[model samples]
Target chain A: MFAHPFLQNAFLAGTFVALAAGLVGWFLVLRAQVFTADVLSHVAFTGALAALAAGLDARIGLFAVTLLVALAMGALGRRARPGDVVIGGVFAWVLGLGVFFLTLYTTVRSGTGNGSAGVTVLFGSIFGLTASRAVGTAVVALVICALLLLLARPLLFASLDENVAAARGVPVRLLGFAFLLLVGGTAAESTQVVGALLILGLLAAPAGAAHRLTTRPLRGLALSAGIAVASVWIGLTASFLVPVLPPSFAILAVASLTYLGAAVGTRLRGTRPTVVER
Target chain B: MTGTFSWNLLADLREMWSLPFMLNAFRAGTIVAVPAALVGWFMVLRRQSFAGHTLAMVGFPGAAAAVWLGIGATVGYLAFGVLAALLFALLPAGRGGGDESSAVGTVQALALASGMLFVALYKGFLNGTSALLFGSFLGITSRQVVLLGVVAAVALTVLALVGRPLLFASVDGDVARAHGVPVRSLGGVFLVLLGVTAAEVGQITGALLVFALLVLPPATVQVLTTRPARGLAASVLLAVVTVWVALFAAYYSPYPLGFWLTTIAFGGFVLAYAGRAVVDRIGRLAVAP
Candidate 1:
């Protein structure tokens, strides 16, 4: 599994994504904007199509649009903000754009008889990874990791107690926008290996499972990164064994199972009831 | 092309009473919206909106895979959604007091990654790609209608029957658990209902926008009302109205139903919020008298 170029590239990509996702996702989970991040993935999709339509690189388009969208979202809500409403607005508009772009792309192409190029972009072609693609993913992941490390404490403070963090002099708005951009960049990089639709799993699942298994934040983050890497490796290798299975599904399956295992473990532990009350 | 919008939507509206396909779209939209409103109420109340979105995203890859393999996408989608939901239900709720959002967010990511991988394998399915994005309310067959009907009925019935206890648990989980309401069990049950809601809505709204109906209405209702029954009523009304209006708009305006419905729903929310703000301001001025 490790010997194959595709698997090796996937491993490297997955590891990088795991680290970034582990850190960013830890904060995302804390902020309760998980759906907001997922919406950005759809936004990324529309951006990809727009870029392709303009004859630009899809990845660059995806990152750029997602970054802009994230900034717009962050700018909407201020201290004691109604962030969810803004997120909700962005979510609907972005999805509407995705559908609209697809329709436009298809209708125009059909008139010219160029044979559906847009459809291929949606499903994504992860097996087409080159050394450069792998290297690009690594660079993005490293930058994200470094930024996350610098901002981790302030971010944790903002996430856990926004009012207090702000009163304590954290630039909460800038940090929030920066974190959103980080999530966007990670999502884009992960999209290359896992595709846009499923990158959320790489972003969210390992951290979630780790959250369940531990209470300490740093320990949880470490566990999340480890779990994310393992799930990706397992998924990439297993998909190869099945021949017809897509690598994204393999990543999802393994991650979901890992989550399942952690969940069951927590349930059986019966230490504390497994339901939160608001 | 007609630049002016007319009663053209009425043609689709009237045909809905006569044509099986049109009727199916209406029926599908209505049935799905009921459970969507109900389960969505809890989703909003508990801040579990991300879980619902994640369940829907989980279904995307399965739907894509089903299309690639020439199978029913709904079945594949349902399987993935249920799995994701159960995993969610099994996590320790107060492990770090941050378990809910963090856990759900992570799983949402995992589900999405899996979906992308599966979608990639089927390199040649036109319907699969379109179906995953825009959806085809007009394209649903009688078989899908029946399937959706059964699932929707089960989901709505469960939601209705469990309404009181679920509310009890949602409003104050610790109190409900102390009173022997089986709070944990209800949480699990709610997630399953959310899973079903995602599957049904996935047919009409596509997997991505499923959260629009499942989360938005109830959440908006939450902003306006404090009473549970009022909130439920408001959510249902908001959802049904948004769906039909969007359905009509899509039928006549030459735009996809998902886009139009989302637009209408979002517009309605803004208008409602604005109306409340204006009314409150006027009431304050009047009180000065």
Candidate 2:
């Protein structure tokens, strides 16, 4: 299945991104910060577009923009009851800027004026992966995964019960900002391989699906990571057969299947009826 | 810079009335905003704002994929929208406080990325996908208007029939369930209805502004009233009015309907809040309570 050099790089890149997404996503699901993740991912788009407009590497630009945006969201979410409004406003503005920047870039294409810039910015072709870009994406993903592992316990403590964690002097607000940064980095890394808009699915679905199978936090994290890795493996293999199929679809189709399987397994495992009171 | 009142603006508005398609577009926008505003009120009350956004985003890929396949955009939009709703319904209930948001977010990401990929697969697809994003009310055809009309009618009818029970469920799930309201079933049924509403509105206002319609009315009412029924009634009325104002403005202005609707909805919310603050201060001073 992995005969081509492109396929080899795609598989490696996919694994790193999926693993980081799975880890951070586990906490994201636990904390109910899916909206934050969505906003951060969109921020990455604006950053990438800005990079493209400036004739720079889109990945670095995406990571920088996303980190700053995520930190700002963390600050806002800590202070306000309607923090979501802030996130929503930022999301809209970033999207508007992305569209505007993308339009400007396309209109002023460097005589490759043949429309290649628009394609790269919009769809992000994984099949045409150069070795260097793939390696860079993989390394970034690995770094994100490492950061997630190191902060796993503190992040989980705060996510599960912020009040209790704060009582215990766990630095909950700081941890929240840190977690948001991790989410941003993971989102940026995953976007390189799976594309930006779909990183939320890759991050949240496996973890969300795992949450369905069990309420135990540690077990949930493990299962989330396992499910994510398995999905990357399956998606890589599936994309081989249908070369026309995009990597994002392969990841989605596989992750969705895993979600269904976990749901069914959980239902079947608890068939014993609870005593009902009239 | 084209000044806000530059001759181009005048020319744009004058030429807008000259075209039959522009008239149809205006009619289409009016028809859409009614149901969209009404349904959007319930959407916010039910705390499905983020879910509604996600559903719209997922519709992106469906539309994009359809564009790639040389098919009608509406078919793709509705198809993906319904599929997303079903996915949400089938997931375990009460899994998280943001069950709808989580499911919708996951699906939105997948839909958006996949749409991009499909558009990328074929060359020369940038222009086609642009319409799905920014949208064009000026060049809308008669067929699209009919389709939008049908979608709006079906969504509104379903919403009306289930509105009471859904409202009950939204206000107090436990009490409703205790009274044999089948809260879960109601959620599933309403999600399907919302799926259709979202698809139609998503086409008109883009995914983002749909939230404006959903969130603004309820939020505005909350600033003024504490009674549930009164709040709901006021919310629906406010939504309808905002839609009316936004539609006419979009018709008169050169910008897209979605942009105008968002700005108008936000403005309406601000106005309502400002009025409430003024009234509260005046009443406090007079009554000395």
Task: Give me the candidate number with maximum DockQ.
Answer: 1
Clashing pairs in 2: none
> Which CAPRI tier for candidate 1?
acceptable
**Across residues B168-239, which tens digit of lDDT does each residue of candidate 1 receive?**
998898899899998888888899888878988887788877878877787678768879988898899989
Q: Candidate 2 regions off by >4 Å? A: A1-4, A54-56, A78-93, A108-123, A214-216, A271-278, B1-14, B64-71, B98-102, B110-124, B206-289
Please give the clash total of every predicted structure, in order. Answer: 9, 0
lDDT for each residue of candidate 2 in B232-264, tens digit (9 for 90 to 100): 677767766766565556565544455555566
Give the range of the ten consecutive residues with the poorest summed lDDT in model 2 chain A. A269-278
For each candidate in turn, the TM-score is 0.83, 0.83
- Tens digit per residue, CA lDDT, model 2, A138-170: 888888888888888877777767788889989
In terms of docking quality, model 2 is acceptable
Q: Rate the local accuracy (lDDT) of all candidates.
A: 0.73, 0.71
Candidate topping lDDT? 1
lDDT of 1 by residue, A100-180 (tens): 666666665566553344444544455667867877887789899999989998887887777788899998877887888
